[model samples]
Target: MIYVILLTTIVLYAVIAIAIHFRKALHNSNSHQINIQIFRTLFLIVSVNIGGYYLNYFQVLIIIPKLGNDIMAIRKWNQIVGILLNVSAASNAPILYFTSTEYRNAFNKEWQTIIKLLSFCEIAAATSIEQI
Candidate 1:
């Protein structure tokens, strides 16, 4: 179920990425070329991570069930794959933040707002505490 959904999403993303790549290729613009490269890199990262996750899922659900409790080695492999998958997933955000100008701009704007809100909250709390 979840595996199917993940597979479907990866397929759809690949299709879109390829379409964008071709579209960008036709234009020959420098920024579009850069964007296509970034898209390819992002696609590779996401696909690898998703594939790792699927492999981990298969090991846990299919391999473990058929092999029973005797195989300690498969269990170890499953744990390793799980850790790698998590690390890749964690890295995705930072990669996008650094690579995509739009994401960086949005993140910066949101971060500033968050900081301002936090500072306001702190001031309000301090004034209320002073009244007591």
Candidate 2:
């Protein structure tokens, strides 16, 4: 049952990501469209990161307690980071959709910060999952 849910979520995300990528490819010559595409990609990345980690959490939570304290801490941390990435990704959508130049510049900076956070979340996911 859980495997079915995880598989569905992953496949759905892959399809969406591919569609977004193709949309970006179609708009390659337009800077505005390209920027929007970049944002879309980032948003999808956030979604995937969150979904993967949360699904992992659900999968392991029952079994992890038996593995002892360190593993549990790692799982909890990954879950929290996944949540943060999701919020950051959602927050970025408005910046892409509705900001003026000055606001866009500031939002761009915020976007950079979010990217860094997302990157860290990816690294954390990779490392922690390895330990698990």
Candidate 3:
């Protein structure tokens, strides 16, 4: 249990530290579209992770000994971060969509590319049929 807590704390700090460092580097050095998208996505991820941790696990830790979890019968410490991890899972697309213009533009460009390719294939098939 202590090992699990230690590992979780280590991972939490590492993730935040790396994200912060990358964000700073992105701001200081490369401000390109892709870089900005990456930085924004990383920020969103960190927010989600921290939010999830706080929502369930952190409260469990604080409330278990300090106060009490009124609803739950068993106060067995859950090794899993939190139920709100699922919240982060569900929220990725919406968060990215709302947060980053580059993400939306890039998404649109990909669909456009696919449509163009399909159209080209259809045109080629039609020309081959005509020749035959």
Candidate of highest lDDT? 1
TM-scores across all candidates?
A: 0.68, 0.32, 0.41
Task: Sort the predicted structures by TM-score, highest score first.
Answer: 1, 3, 2
**At residue 47, what lDDT does model 1 achieve?**
72
Cα lDDT tens digits, model 2, 1-132, are: 856765676687667666666563444467657556555655555565556556556646764656477876767766766676556536545644453455578778989999999999999999999998
Selected candidate, larger TM-score, 1 vs 3: 1
Clashes of each: 0, 0, 0
lDDT of each: 0.77, 0.64, 0.65
Which regions of candidate 2 deviate over 4 angstroms? Answer: 23-28, 35-132
Per-residue accuracy of model 1 over 41-87 as CA lDDT, tens digit each: 66876776787777777777777777666668667767787787778
State the lDDT of candidate 3 residue by residue for 52-112, as single tens digits: 7555666566655664554353344442444455676567777777778877788789889
Supply the TM-score for candidate 1.
0.68
lDDT, candidate 2, equals 0.64
List the pairs of residues colliding in candidate 1. none
Residue 2, model 3: Cα distance from true site in angstroms: 13
Error in Å for residue 99 of model 1: 1.1
Candidate 1's C-alpha runs over 4 A off are 24-28, 58-92
